[model samples]
Target: MENRIQLSFTVDKSLLLREAISQYGISKKALTSIKFEGGQIIVNGEEKTVRHILEKGDIVTIVFPKEKKSEGLIAEEMCFPILFEDEHLLVISKKSGMSTIPSREHPNGTLANGIAGYLEKNSSVSTVHIVTRLDKDTSGIVCIAKHRHAHHLMSEMQKAGSIFRTYEAIVHGSVEQDSFLIDAPIGRKDTSIIERRIDPEGKQAKTSVEVIKRFTVNGENLTHVRLKLFTGRTHQIRVHMMSVGHPLIGDDLYGGSLAIMPRQALHAKQLKLVHPFTKQALTIEDEYPMDIAAVLEKATIDK
Candidate 1:
C-alpha cells in the first residue's frame, strides 16, 4: 500500500535538493523517476525540481510508490552476550563475521536484529538505540543506548574525542618503529561507490600504533600492534596500516596475502566512555579473538 505524508511547515528556500530528499526519506533515484514520469510529485499544485526552495504556506505533496516486501527478508532472534546493561545504555561484544545491521543479503543474523529480538523478549528493557557501529568482520565491544536523549549524549561524547577506542591487530610486516602515528586524509575513491582511500584532499584521519610483539611466520615478519584512533573514518586502521607498508594479515582488500587468515586481523580490545545516566567514566576490555591468538601462537612457535 502506498502512503502519503503531508507537511505543514515551511521549508527554507535555500535548502539543497539532496537535503530535501534526505528529510523526506525518499531515494534520489525514486525522486528523479517520479519527475521523469510527470505529475507525480506536486509541490504547491505543480511539479518542481528536487532543488526547488519553499516559502511560507507552501504545500508539498509527495506520492510514495508501493514497495513489495522481499520474501527473503527473514527476521530471526539470536542471543547476544550482554557485557553491561543499565537504564540508559547496554554494551556487548560483537563477534567477527557478524554484521551490525540487517542488509539485503543478510536480512537476519545481524547484531541489530538480534538485539531487537532480545529487547522484545525482555520486557524490563525499553527503548533500544545504537550509538556507534562496528564493521562486520571486526570483532569488538559496541555500545547501545536505551533512549534517544542518551544516544545523543553518547554520540556527542564520541565526536568530541571524550570516548577512547583501542584495537589489536596482527600485520604482515614487523614495525621497525616502537611507536608511530599515521596522519592521512581519506575520501571516497569513487563517488559512485562506497570504497574509501587515502586522499590528500579528504577529511583528516589519524591513528597511533605501538608494536607489542614481533616474530616470524612462514619466513615473513609479523607484528602484533595496538592502535589508537584519534579520528574515526571508514577502514581507517586498515587503510592507514596499508599506507605504512604493513597491511593487516588476511586483509586481502588492503594488500594482505591469503596465506594468513581469511579476514582482517583486527580486534577492538578496549573502549572508554562516560556513562550517559551516571556521568561516570566506564572502561571495558575484551580478549583477542581466537584466530588472532592462533596467529600469535604460530609466530611464537616459529621464533
Candidate 2:
C-alpha cells in the first residue's frame, strides 16, 4: 500500500517555495526525505524545486514519501471499539489483556497487528503510528496517527503539555485527600528491564490524584480515584500510587494485591487535545469495562 499523504495549499502571497513550506511547519527532516526519498513537490500541476518562486494563488502540493510498515508486525484480525476517526488520526478503546504493540512474548495478538489488519481490510495504508499507549493489562483509549506528519505534530503537542489524559483507578485503601499531586522523578530500576522506580537522578514526573469515591469491598477499604498525568513517564501512575502507600488493586509489579482482580485496576478514561490538522479542541471518553464495573458493583460507598 502507498502509505503517504498529499497536501495542497494555495499561496496567499508571492514567495519562495521553501519559505512557504517553512511557514507551514514542514520539518527539515521531512523535506530531506521528500528530496532524497520518493516524493514530489508540485507547483500548479508541475513538479518544482524548493527554490521555485511562487505567485499569489499558486497551488503548491506536496506528496509525502511512502512510509515503510514496521518489520515483523504481522497483520492479524481483531476488532476494537472505535471512538473517533478522521483522515489524520483515530481513537480506539482497547480491552484489557491486550498489549499495545507486538513484543517477543506476545507478537501476533496485539493492538498494532489488529490495526494493521484493519487498515489493510479498508484498503488503507497499513503502517501504524501509535501516539498514545497503555499498559498491556490497562484497558482504555489509544490514539493513532495515520501518517508521519500527523505523528510529528502530535509529538510536539505532547511535549508542549497540550495533550491531557485522565484515568480512573481503584486502589487498596481509602484516600483521605480530595486532591493531591505526586511530583517525583522516574527512572529505570537497575534490577529489572521492565520495572520503573522513583529516583532523584531521573526525569521529572507528576501526577494529579482526585478522590472520586471512598468505599468498602469484601470488608476491605477501597478507593476509586481519578488521575491526571502532568508528565509522561513509564509506569508513572503505578509507581506514584505505590509511593503514596496506596497501590492500585491487582498491580502485582507495584506491591498490589491480586485478590479481586488479576490485572491493574487502571483505565484510561478520557483524553483532551487539539486536533493537529484542524486546530479544533477534542475531548474523548470511554466507559468503564465490565471487570472494573463488577468490582465497583460489589463495593459499598463510604458516607
Candidate 3:
C-alpha cells in the first residue's frame, strides 16, 4: 500500500522564505522546485509561490508524493545484525558479500531484501528508506530510515556535514606516517568495470588515514589503519589508498594481490548523526569481520 503524509503548520507574520529555508535547512532551489511541481506546498490552503508572503495564522500544508516502488523487486531472507532501532531509524551491521540493494543479477541476497523481511516480520514499519550505501564487498555500519520524512531529514543532515563516518582497513604495506590526509580526485577509468582511478577531472575526494598497528603477516608487511572520510565518493578509500601505493589487502580491483582474504579488508567501523525525530546525537559502531580479524591476528604473531 502507498502511504500518504499531510503536514500542517502556521506561519508567523515575520516569516520569510529565507527564514523558512534557514529553519528547514532546505535549499531555495529545492523549495522552488517543489512549489513548481504543484500541490506540494500550500499557504492558507492555496497553492503558493516560493516568494509568497506569509501572515500570522496562515496555515501551510505540505503533501508529499509517494515513492514509486520498482517492479519485480525480489524479496529474500537474510539476517542483519541489528545494532539499534527506533521509531525513526535503524542501524545495522551489514556483512560482507551482501549487496545493499537489488541490482541486475543480485535481486535477492541483498541487505535491502533482508531489511524488508525484518520489517515485514515486525509489522511496525510501513516504509523503509536507505540513507547510505556501502559497497557489496565492504562490511560495516549502515543506517535505514523507517519513514519518508525521517529519510528526507536525515539525508539533508548528511549533506550539511552533520553526519560522520569512519572506516577500518588493512592495507598491504606499512604506513610510515602516523596520520595523513589524501586529497585526490577520482573518476571512472576510460575502459573498466568495477574500477576507479585518480584523475584530474574527477570529483573531489578526501580521506584521513591513521595507522592503528603495524606488523608482518607471512613475511609480508601489513598495516591496520583507521580512515575518516570528509567526502564520500565511489571507491574513494580504495582509490586513495592505491594512489598512495598502499592499497588495501585483498582489493583485487585497485591493485593489492593478497588472496589470503576473500573480500576487500574494509569495514565501516563508526557512524554518527542526530536523530531525525528526537534531535539527539546517535553514534554506532560495528566490529571487524571475522576474516579480516583472523588476518590481523595472524599478522600479530611477530614473525
Most TM-score-accurate candidate: 2
List the RMSD of every prediction in angstroms: 10.6, 1.8, 4.1
lDDT of 2 by residue, 4-95 (tens): 68878999999999999887778899899899988889999999999999999999989988888788899989989999998889899999
Candidate 3, residue 93: Cα displacement in angstroms equals 0.9
Residue 283 accuracy (lDDT) in model 3: 86
Candidate 3, residue 127: lDDT: 53
Cα lDDT, model 2, residue 164: 99
Clashes of each: 0, 0, 0
**Candidate 1 lDDT, 1-303, residue by residue in tens:** 123212223456656544665564455565664556332555677866777766645666664433332234343577756778876678888899998877777677888777776665665223346776888889888888754445556766788998899999999887999999999999878753656789998999999999999899889999999999998898899989999899998888889876879988999889888775466888988877788888888888998
Q: Alpha carbon lDDT of residue 163, candidate 2?
A: 95
For residues 110-186, could you state the per-residue lDDT of candidate 3 as single tens digits? 88888777866776434558988899999999999875666778878887888899999999888999999999999
The whole-model lDDT of each prediction reads 0.75, 0.92, 0.79
Candidate 1, run of 10 with poorest lDDT: 1-10
How accurate locally is residue 156 in candidate 2, as Cα lDDT from 0 to 100?
83
In candidate 3, which residue ranges exceed 4 Å CA deviation? Answer: 1-70
Best by lDDT: 2
Candidate 3 lDDT (Cα, whole model)? Answer: 0.79
